[model samples]
Target: MQKILCFTALFASLVLTFLNTQSEAAIGANEIIRFSWRANTEPVTGYKLYYAEGAVTGPPFNGKNALQGNSPINVGNVTQTSLSGLDVHQNYSFALTAFNECSESAFTDVIIVYSVTISIHGNGTVGTYTSFWTENHGNETIHFFPSDGHFVSNVVVNGTSFGSTESITLNDVTEKKVIDVYFSPEKTVERDTSFPLWSGSFNENADVQGSIFIASDGVYVSQTTDTYTTNISKVSDGFCPKSGWNANYHLIQFIDVDNDGWLDIAGFGYNGLVVAYGIDGTNYHTAVNVISGNFGYNNGWRIDHHIREISDIDGDGVNDVWGFGYNGLVVAYGIDGTNYHKPKLALNSFGYNDGWEITDYRRFLDVDNDGYLDISGWKDGVNYVSLFNSANETYDNIVEWW
Candidate 1:
């Protein structure tokens, strides 16, 4: 019986020793911190790592507090063996538990990691005489010149850098003066190019309310008011469809249609005569049969709509007659030596409200230099000009006159 009792005590001691050893060998605090543990006898199917800022202590830890406990927030589930997002420049506490149907391992050692954010700015300028630099994103530099085309200096922007040499010559300017700044990651680089992105000029003496006519030779100019002497004569035979013996038209120009240097007078009339008088020194000699059997007629009426005086409609060398009739129809006719070509109709639609009567039509001028000539006129108390591109045949709604 004594021997049996001794054996029983030994067996109990051995079992207790084995249990203690297993518990001791369970995931160590250091191993947990490094996430270096493999599947143990307990079969760690997953893991739960808990971390908090500040120091930790004790086995079944108690009385231990987190530095950032007041703002405790979950960093979220991560499958990786190691994790991050701990407060930089500060200590942190951590623990790991092998999660499965059975039980978890021990707590882990504390760790610390560091992190930060930053920003930067830069700029510069260039020109003949004056130069400046700025951190401001203005990114544009302006160099001005006096009327004599002399460079004006003394330019500066606050909180900026200007190179050592200050003086520059105005004669170094291009026809279309412009300086461009190229931006780099660290500094702004300036480059001067020949073409100016934007350019314009204002003429104080420009004739706005006038007729712009292009002659057969393609010379264009505006005639503001009548510069003619009217010589009225009664016609005994009725020449026009409408019964009127008082038909007369005024001469508006003398164009050298053949470019022979000598000018010819072009006359306007109301069912009367369109005589071309050749210049003979100071006096003029009438050209014979210059109007016989010609379809040219003044129509005996004037409509206040915008009239398109004669010009090259098809871009052909010869000048074609273009005008807006009283009925709001745009008419174009080719002019030969004896007769006029059939009128090509444009914008002809019945009951189509034009909003305002046609006032005039003129050759396109690309005011914006967008390579399109814009037509300008008055409509409904507003004068507007639309731009048309000859190359693309596209029209832009940029009106400007009124």
Candidate 2:
């Protein structure tokens, strides 16, 4: 079977610098923000910019002060313009509409940004600033990360449950305040196929604006008219990856193991940290230091590089996760649902190591139609396949595609 596997840690430096550029809020002054965008269709006289403080619930805003007040600021005639007299530290919504003598187009989707500053406690760090920063913190969402060898427990502010997620816009914290965050030792006993398979947002469009997929070196989300897409904020570990599977560690895989409807994000650096974001469906996620200290190339055995997935190999109720890396090497975490059973190097090569090689490509499929999932990929310009041996929970047999 063909394979599709695509997937950090400059940590936080530039952001911290920007956040530290100005501590005191630029309170009560007009800030100039230049705006530029594509031009409208023909027959258009000009474009109109409509803005309102906070969310734009609806029209019929107080037109009396619409022209001047920080709320409902309207301007016309120019393709682009500079917004001034903006209220500092306040969330603002803006929409654009084209106008001619005949009529005006419907206002585009409203884009909003609120002011915010995030801080972290304990030995872990979160976001760029600690507090009192002039950031347009709209929907303030920050993940809490703990130190090594730990699982985030007894977390506060970010919400309930370990590494809960909360929306700052909805939380409505008008004043600056200190949020206390904590972590705890984890009792995760790595078992074969025990850890739930990583699942994206359940209930569709609930956790994401659109469907999520990976390509090349980036994880991407596509918007469809069938449903909206999830808005992606900056994932931890920095921008995109710079190298091979090394950066894959920063790839955030989403899983809802408890089936609580909330998606938890997992980030791995192998030698570094394996972080899980948002344990519960609390609309929030924390940095959650791979504190659990399990299933990593650093803390323990090394594996799970470019790809990983959870599944039941045999009829057994237990779950198993497999990771495919370079050189046709495969690592398996054998957990019988709740406890670790057999854990070791699952596969070295599909038996053609001398000439063929597995290069960042693999997918589990029952190619032989034996009702059991098999690992398949292209090697030496041909297809190489394997089947899961229920007795030992390993992939066996090597066949080359004609």
Indicate the residue-level lDDT of 347 in model 1.
Answer: 36
Which 10 consecutive residues of model 1 have the lowest summed lDDT? 11-20
| Model 2 ranges with Cα > 4 A deviation | 1-249, 257-260, 277-306, 309-319, 326-329, 334-343, 350-360
Task: Write candidate 2's Cα lDDT for 1-402 as tens digits.
Answer: 433221101111111111222222332344444555556544455666666666554553322223244433445654566555554445555666666666666666555444443333435445323232223433434555556754333334444233323222224344434444543333222211212222334332453322333333333322221321232212232212432334323444565422344454454445433433433332334344432343455533333334545445544455454455433434434343323443345677642233432244567778778777787887546777777776786778666645
Write one digit per residue (lDDT tens) for candidate 1, span 181-277.
2212211112111111111110122211221222222212121223111111111112222322122322234444332233343433443224343
Q: How well does each candidate superpose onto the true structure, as a TM-score?
A: 0.28, 0.35
Task: Give one clash count per candidate, in the order shown.
Answer: 13, 33
Highest-lDDT candidate? 2
Q: Count backbone clashes in candidate 2.
A: 33
